[model samples]
Target: MNAYGSYVEFDRARWAALRSRTPLRLSEEELQRIKGLNDKISLQEVEEIYIPLTRLINLKVRAAQYLDEVTSAFLGCEPVHKPFIIGVAGSVAVGKSTVARLLQTLLSRWEHHPTVDLVTTDGFLYPTRVLEEKGLMARKGFPESYDTKKLLDFLTRVRAGERQVEAPVYSHVTYDVLPDRSEIVDSPDILIVEGVNVLQVSKGQPVFVSDFFDFSVYIDAEEQEIRNWYIDRFLLLHRTAFRDPSSYFHRYAELTEREAVERATNIWETINLLNLNENILPTRGRADLVLSKGPDHQIHRVFLKDL
Candidate 1:
């Protein structure tokens, strides 16, 4: 191990060299469909970076299954089936959604053809009314802003082999949890859970969101880079989704470009930056893998948790 005791680091060239004979399973079109707003990842990057990363994850999944069987056999008990859970964490606009989606697509193409599911922890955030009542509207992405009990219960049921589990759905257009609807996740072979706070530990909570993860990843970027990405994304939303009459940010559509940018900068500075510095950044070392990105938003290094 290097001086970073927990992880052995690899630069892009070395990390990309870890790619085995695993063939690329995704096309550029499919990748474009899954790519997040303002996050640019070329097909070449997928081949060099993500494909190799997915291969590593596949190895871990197989190892985990073997351990499960061996442990069950040693205990002379029947093995209970459980999905391999992956936690993907990062700051807002750090391209975590893209990573989660890409992994889901690639992992599903493995020889075993394991069923994969993707869920974002945004769905677990408390409703706007609830946040308003608690006077936490401005502190929205913090740990306390989530309905921790509900999220914990959902994961508990998933790990318990419960089928047809339903989770609340949050809409970006509405910017709130949909009261009348939820998204159902049947028992899957793999579940990718992504969010800004997936790796966070709550002080009084008995179970952390990461406790259920078989493997976890933290997407890393400098604070200023993330801040710029967030503002850029905000501007993009203003021109597109924010222009919709039903959008929560529709009012922003009318602002001058300068005003919109100013507002986005303010939100990033006051809200997202605070959450990242105080909560998200502190949890980076806890991840099983860390993908550090350059200012261009391309992953430049990998840090694998050393056994």
Candidate 2:
């Protein structure tokens, strides 16, 4: 492995070699279904990158299980089962969601962990009304826009193996949290938590969100690449989702192509970029593993923390 600061860096080819003949478990259709709007992932990429990643995670899970059993036996107590939580964090358009979803799907297919669940921090974002009241509408994706206490409590209960724990649901179409709805998370064998702020450290909080993660990943790319992806995604949405009358961004559907580009660029610069620099990017070093992407959205390199 190539050494890179505190991490062991692996280029795409090297990282792919770690698959160790693991069979490709995902189909192209499935990959297409899970990829983000502007993200590019192929079955080849899955076989090379994600398959090996999941294999590594599987080994970790097995070790954790064995440790739990050994500790229980040593203490003359019954073994307690707890979900292995994985946190995936990144910037607005860095494709962390795609990675998280892929992990949930692949990890569940493994015989040892048949139950894998996925959750996004988007659900924990404050509602539009609350943000408006707090004067944080423009800062929606920033750390302050989240209900950290609620999120922490949710993770605490999940970690304790609480049954039927509920998390708030978020609607992308409305760009707000649904007050009347929630996601019930039954204790699964593995839980993948994905979001922009999952790795963030709260200054005054006694416990941070990352404390609940057994493993964490940061999806990385140059700032300019992410900015382009965000703009491209906005343009795609302008032609599609934003055209829906019920969409919160429907107003953008009326704009010309140039106007849409300008507006999207402005939002990216003024809000998402600031959030990335001030809150998100700083947490990159905190991740257990980091997947760095190329401009084409393919993960070109991986930086994994040494065990």
Candidate 3:
């Protein structure tokens, strides 16, 4: 295998060849629903790439279960059914959300793990008022913008196999944490956590967000490509979602197309790019798997850590 730190590298062709007898379970309509705004993922990509990836994850799940059982038996305790948690981390506009959702759907379809739940770290971000008070209004996606203690506490509870744990809900339209709304995490067989900062280290905290992850994936792509996609998505939102009076970005929607694009580019260059370089990209090597993508937003290579 090709080398990448302690990982094995596989080109798209080689990675595709790993698929074996995994059924093509999703339809075009379902894919359309799963895809993020302006993101492209064909069914063939799922068959050739994600099918094998999910198969591998299932294997890991079974292995984890066996280890848990053995450990419990050795300690003279009953087996505790702690759910397997998978963390998906990436730069903004890299399609980590889509990957996380797809994996949740695919893994849930398997008999071995039928109760997959997906949660995004967006829900952990501080409220707009809090951010404004903290003077982090423009750094919304950065690690400091999140309520790290609450997020870590939630994950700790999940790791202890706690049930009925509720997560705060964040709205993209309003760009703030929803008031009095939460997503309950029942006893799921598997949980997928997706966000830009999932893999990042929380300074001065002993328990990191990634500490609860049984497996993790980091999506990789060229900075320029990601920037272009981010701008495109921003423009699309400006024309549609941002046009709503209730949208946080309604002011941007009023700008001319050229002005809107310029604003998006400036945000990317100043905030997103800086975060990607300093924080997100630095965590790539720590992931269990890295899905490297081309300018087309399609995964072209995979790097799996040596197991």
TM-score of each predicted structure versus truth: 0.96, 0.98, 0.97
| lDDT for each residue of candidate 3 in 5-44, tens digit (9 for 90 to 100) | 7898988889888887778889999999999999889998
lDDT of each: 0.91, 0.92, 0.92
Summed over model 2, clashes come to 0
Poorly placed runs, candidate 2 (over 4 Å): 1-4
Give per-residue CA lDDT, model 2, range 50-92, as digits (tens). Answer: 9999999999999988998999999999887789999999999
Candidate 1 residue-wise lDDT, 1-307, digit = tens = 6543589899988888888778998898999999999988998899889989899889888888788899999999998878899999999999999999999999999865379999999999999999999999999999999998899999999998799999899999999999998988888889999999999987777889899999999999989899889989999998899999999999899999999999999999899999999999999989999999999999988899988
Instruction: List where candidate 1 sits over 4 angstroms from the true fold.
Output: 1-5
- What residue pairs clash in candidate 2, if any at all? none
lDDT of 1 at 23: 92
- Model 1 poorest ten-residue lDDT run: 1-10
CA displacement after TM-score superposition, residue 50 of candidate 2 (Å): 0.4
Supply candidate 3's per-residue lDDT for 162. Answer: 90
lDDT (C-alpha) at residue 168 in model 3: 93
Candidate 3 TM-score to native: 0.97
